[model samples]
Target: MTSSADAPRSGPVSAWAPLAIPAFRVLWFAQLGSNIGTWMQTVGAQWYLVDA
Candidate 1:
């Protein structure tokens, strides 16, 4: 059995490690902004078009 200290580390330790890379951070934020915009649009559409 491997002890916690002896275990081989795998993958990025920090959740934000992927965003540390310039290319990944750019793409991630772009996607995040797009998703936020889409969410706002959907909410606006529902508010304007749906009956109470």
Candidate 2:
């Protein structure tokens, strides 16, 4: 039989834990904005090509 001390400690992990860091939060937002801009540019190019 396993005692309480021998049992594995399972804890709930927060998804937003990493965003708690100021540097990480800044980089995350910057990356998100870059991805959105790239997506918009791609869509615009496709629409222009299709219409031309």
Candidate 3:
């Protein structure tokens, strides 16, 4: 019997292959935007507190 190590591979797999899925892509961008907004709000709050 052939060993698993001897099996042929299609090629190198991409790290971003999961982003190809439509639902996952949308969720990922949504999360990214949310995180950016949160960060900006935190920074703005800090600046306002410091300036007051």
Candidate with better lDDT, 1 vs 3: 3
> What are the per-residue Cα lDDT tens digits for candidate 1 across 1-52?
7899799788769887688799999999999999999999999999988865
Which stretches of model 1 miss by more than 4 angstroms? 1-12
For model 1 the TM-score comes to 0.69
lDDT of 3 at 2: 97
TM-score each candidate: 0.69, 0.78, 0.76
Error of 2 at 37 (Å): 0.2
Candidate 3 or 1, higher TM-score:
3
Task: List residue ranges in candidate 3 displaced over 4 A.
Answer: 1-11
Candidate order by decreasing TM-score: 2, 3, 1
Name the candidate, 2 or 3, with the larger TM-score value: 2
Tell me the tens digit of each residue's lDDT in model 2 across 1-52.
9999798768986899899899999999999999999999999999999999
| C-alpha lDDT (0 to 100) for residue 6 of candidate 2 | 100
Global lDDT of each model?
A: 0.89, 0.95, 0.96
**Backbone collisions counted per model:** 0, 0, 0
